[model samples]
Target: MPASPREEDVLTARELYRFYRAGEEETLALRGVSLRVRRGETVAVVGPSGSGKSTLLGCLAGLDEPSGGEVRVDGVRISHRPETERARLRALHIGVLLQTRNLLPHLSVRDNVRLPQRAAGRKPVTSARELLAQVGLGERMDALPRQLSGGELARAGLAVSLANSPAVLLADEPTGELDGETERMVLAMLRDRAAQGCAVLIVTHSAEVVRSADRVIALEDGRTTAATAPAGGAVPAEVSDATG
Candidate 1:
């Protein structure tokens, strides 16, 4: 099937700041970070361990509230919405693949992929099968998480994330645990998602992942300071000061 037309701005964060307080100390995780992502585009967020990459993704996915500024997803102000409303919006519009696999140990691969649909109260799309096929796991639909290799489990996680046909896909270290070949396969799947009109945002420390992105944004000490456009669509260099 042909992909939808690219939307101008599928996700945006303006003057975003996040802070956490521990007794007498207050720590700032994200400092005045602002970004925009268009539909059918892949953007990579690279930073060190404390640079706030995950915090930014959390805010963008409406999984956490920002201390200040705003996050808009599909033109809806996610930062201002009530928790229940924001969660509903996320269920309807966003898919996230964290660094850790979140599949249920007791569920088969196919059932795990279908979990998101059940949560969202939405019907599953036939594309779920195609997604599994794309990830090279078409034959493992009946396997349990423990029955699959690390790579196969990752592929299943990817397929599950797509169950909602989400407008925005936020992935954190989607290939962190894979071998070189498996990483390539996972990156290919992510690129295809962007090509299919989903705004793809990935947080990673991998040079390969950075290179695959359409644009690369670097974070330093919780601040965004550098961005590089793709060079003839080639993978770019590792540009962030953050390690993970």
Candidate 2:
């Protein structure tokens, strides 16, 4: 069954704008992008490269301060919080999977998965073994990053992202490094998280990812000008039997 939406949204953004200043010019990455993700909802943000998909994720995750507008996560306005507070809140409540697998080269997969818990000043509640198993990395828990295949490393990163059982999961190009089958597996895991009541948002260019979402929001030239729900009008299935 689909999880119920929380009375309060898990994530809300209003008129968000981000701009980078060069010596004599400014580049607008996001312009007036407003979005909301209710608890138990899965939203996919899609656009071509440089369309500000990643930038939107960063702003939503509180990794970057927006040049203008408001962003609230878990009902708190994190966009204006102090850096330390933002970092602390993120550690406690947000799970982020970036395009790059930013694992520590010296740490084994198990250790890397537990790092987030340690950073949050909490003992790891979710067993690394269990998480690795969920990601199909149970046998590779002791493997170092260099010894793992690209897909294995990606799964490890995902397991680490779920370390806190966060209220929100933010993934950017999560399946970019995986093969077709692995990508399906990863998306299924994400769908399971949303089914379990986490607000899941993925920023990707993949058609498969978009189709898996409850809603698809498209960005063009730094603005969200298109938003659509699936034609069937039923909630997305947990897993699609079809393949890319």
Candidate 3:
């Protein structure tokens, strides 16, 4: 895929490679990943555990730097930027939903969502109330994180992720551990974001997420094994290795 300028693409990765090194040993987590996610599209990265799903997300989110290749989010080259700079861009243009560290237990839903916007260093931050309502948590905005049920907490986390009207959204197993109702709500919110022109990328095993995606990229053993693009999908490539 061509890594064009940001006029059309919200996210782009060109020939990405990531490797971990130890004494006399090395592991390649990603090998030559190249793709593009345009505005208003949801792309799902699906594979078994340890197939470099999290690593891919980290690289895309600028939480980790790739050993080779480039990544751009909303026109910013973040693949190898300093952590501080990356965090700055992430605050302004990215919304992240992960299984861990998504919410602060001591904070109310409203406050939790506000925190990131406060640090985002941007004016006209997203409205907490509007965001909460969009996720069907308007009535629970003032409730503390620990005071909510599992489903409510999930919705709350999503509201927090969208606190800044991010241009690109990154999620890791966003529907995991949620009840049926909560899962549907989350999925709908994700699709809605895409419709609103926010590029959404998720690493997931959930059937619902796969179904919701405009495209699906499957990885195995740290390399892309197969990919189903949105337009004129191609046959899945070959597979390799034992586990992810």
lDDT of each: 0.82, 0.83, 0.83
Per-residue lDDT of candidate 2, residues 70-104 (tens digit): 78778778897888888888888899997685588
lDDT of 2: 0.83
Pairing residues by index, what is the TM-score of model 1? 0.89
Assess candidate 2 and give its TM-score to the true structure: 0.89
Residue 80 in model 2: lDDT = 78
Tell me how far candidate 3 lies from the true structure as C-alpha RMSD in angstroms.
Answer: 3.7
TM-score of each: 0.89, 0.89, 0.90
- Model 1: residues >4 Å from true position, as ranges? 1-7, 127-130, 232-244
lDDT of 3 by residue, 126-227 (tens): 588888998888998889888988888888888888999999999988877876667888899889889999999988877666766888889888787666
> Model 1 — which ten-residue stretch has the worst lDDT?
235-244
